[model samples]
Target: MGFRFRDVLTSWAVPSLADLLLAALVVRPYLLPGGLDELLSDASVGMHIRTGDLIRSAGSLPHTDPFSFALPGKEWFAWEWLTELSLSLLHSWFGLAAIALAAVVLMTATSALVLRNSLRRGESAFLGLLLVMVGFQTSMNHALARPHLITWLFLALSVTIVERERRGPWRGFWLLIPLAALWANLHGGFAILPVYLAVVCTGLGLEAIWNRTSWRGVWRMVACGLAVGAATVVNPYGIGLHQHLIEFVSSPWAIQMIEEYHPPSPSLGEPFYWFAALGALAGLTAVSALRRRGVSDALVCLFFLISACKSARHIPLFVIAVTPIVAGELRWLWDVARRHGGRRSLVAIVHDMDLGLRPQFLRHSSWLPSLFLLALAFRGPLGLPSTFPEKSFPVEMVERNSATLQAGRVFSTDAWGDYLIYSGYPRQRVFIDGLQDYFGPALGNDYLEMLSGGPRTEELFRHWKFDTALVPVKQPLSRWLKARPEWRVVAETPLAVLLVKEH
Candidate 1:
């Protein structure tokens, strides 16, 4: 197993296109303008980190609304506490940059695993590279620094293991068992793992019935499925986590109110374009898979396609799970076209280009690992902001009005409410924040009514005793507050306005 000169030359001197792409994927996000800031733009990261700190100090996970005066002592599920703890540790040690780096690492790991799985499935590197961009696009769309980033990595890893098991022995498939446990602790998305394994097993059983797959494979899938399912319950909440996720995902109210729960629109551009394109290609692939009794793919594709169609958040799940299938389909289509069509056509050119890429395709080098390490070392020191961007959040405004924000019963946007918690948690509380599930429709609707300057605005404000209000300066809510004789604008930034009620 000693390395020859040729091996050394190829492995050390020249990296593959995949290797370089992996490097670019990791560094580009942090290097781009406001990229690190953009990752922290979501206020949920603040919730998770603060919750982590609370858990760490108290030596237990929180079960009540710890950051909100609106719903104090409500039965709250801090289901993602493991991820929160991790984020807390990173932020505690390295500031916000570490969380950004962690996110980049998660996204990069997902992408790298997808690429490896694609190449392993005999996908042509040229086409694989192009189609895998769909996964990258999905990552960029939801690139916020949160626990779900961990889910992205786990999803890609779990799917790849399942696919490999279908083709070969259940060698590394056992990893999913412990992975399920860990994923269960990290994010609510762990529910998807058991569902995915069940889908794959069902598909394998269908293939077995058609004699396209061995019964051994089907039984192995069943064993793996049961193992993973059993392992998932080995979390802090046990089966309760599953129950909570079921209720959350099934809640029609959540579907109507939460933006991510809504179906993706094509008009949103490239993210949806890739999703729509891959979805169409997946349909064709699934149909073709049926002839060979490879119903595993058909089921997998069909299930995820519907999931993607129903929720924009599930778009990444589809992209990670189905893009390889789409890449294989593209390859099959390319091969057919090249064989039957004119020699000088686009098909012939792509075929030739793919052939040219083959030698470098398999080459491995230190570039990707080296670049990732470098990115990690430089990330914090490199232009990472100490807090959420001022342009995005009312960072300076919060500092300037700290007295009013911390001491008074404050009302603000859900996002800014989250920031308020981050800034003055264990002391100050918000009228509401982005934890819409915790708040429920009753309170969320009331908050929305307040924002709308609706009939409930006065009654709710009086009931809640909200003496301090912070909102985006340009919103009608701000103007509405300013119009009230009992309220006066104390300060205003281009991004946010602070209003205090006249006593």
Candidate 2:
């Protein structure tokens, strides 16, 4: 063993850690602290909590609750009613910090689970780190306090369970059934669960057929999956739940209103995600060719690759679900170097070469070591920014307007919805929230019209009956409002504008 070989290993180790750490740190900037969507979700949570209070006053879930966006004459999910109620109660007890802490905790725990699942399949810790880095990068765009967080966690857990045994543990699958019930109540995206489970079952079915294995395993998986699907109906909605989902999707408003439903624009804002997807696809193809192809592996890769390419937000799901499959496919590549006749000689040389290097120089834990590597990479292939903020929000404005905000309804952009909700100001009701489905096509058209300098903007405003409009200074609404005598600027800053109706 020589010092040179040890030096070589240390050099290799250092860059890998740095690459991951830099990715982690860089992705952190995308997280939303005060984005409009967060503000909306938070405000919705607050209102739902207040509505629950009113329900306690009026008795039973009121047929129509004003504090909630789920009013009559409107198509609504009320999916997050429980989460809102819970968050509202938490806000009452622990305040905004606690609610925010809850969001962070959910995100961190889900991230760790995804990482754990990735590592369980023989992936290097680096792969988990990379996947998390990519997840944060994608999810950060809409990092508001919303039910998607719960869905993301559930998806990760369900996928992990499905991987080990497609039948999934009976008890665990039943537990997930209830979680699905909760998820149905929490968010409309619970549909992903059924779809994911279907995919898993199909994978298992294919595996059974291909290997000529026992139908017992396949049948058990199919049965559990059907049971889980049935449990989704346990909610108050009954069969209306499925009907509601169908109607929601069929509605022109649903497709027109939601950004997530919109297909990806390769020309803007998602180059990295697209790059990763393309690379993963190419990598998967190479891996598939190198080994015996499995139907499930091919299907999973195709499914996620298509999904991610179709929408930017779907990137996190692809990264979470597809990365493991990619890694598994590439497992053969990891073995390639060992196949050559000189492999043993190379291994001996490498081992002997590292003998003299200090153990301190050979560190390889995770992102912590990756930090130094990131700094160097930033100047090269990584090309990440040198300094990244831990938070991606205008906290000063939030603190400054907290009291005023507590006194009124806020009309905000999609980005700041959850932040306002989490702020827990009782007087606050948001004009909109992340429940983009609730708004339907009409409101979305109106919003687009408004943002695009629509002439009927004022009429649309009167229609929604908004109290106060909080917008980024750059919005066309700011300019439009400033010219209108009916609206007065209440607060103005370089970053944002708060406008209130003139008395």
Most accurate candidate by TM-score: 1
Estimate the TM-score for candidate 2: 0.71
Q: 318-437 in candidate 1: lDDT tens per residue?
A: 878887776766677778888898889887887787778865655657776676567667765666667887887888888888888899999899888888888876677888888777
lDDT of each: 0.80, 0.59
Count the clashes in each prediction.
0, 37
TM-score to native of every candidate shown: 0.92, 0.71
Query: For all the candidates, what are their Cα RMSDs to the real structure?
Result: 2.6, 9.1
Candidate 1: list runs displaced more than 4 Å.
1-15, 25-33, 338-366
**Candidate 2 ranges with C-alpha deviation above 4 Å:** 1-62, 68-77, 123-139, 166-175, 265-271, 274-279, 282-291, 341-425, 428-433, 458-472, 485-490, 496-503
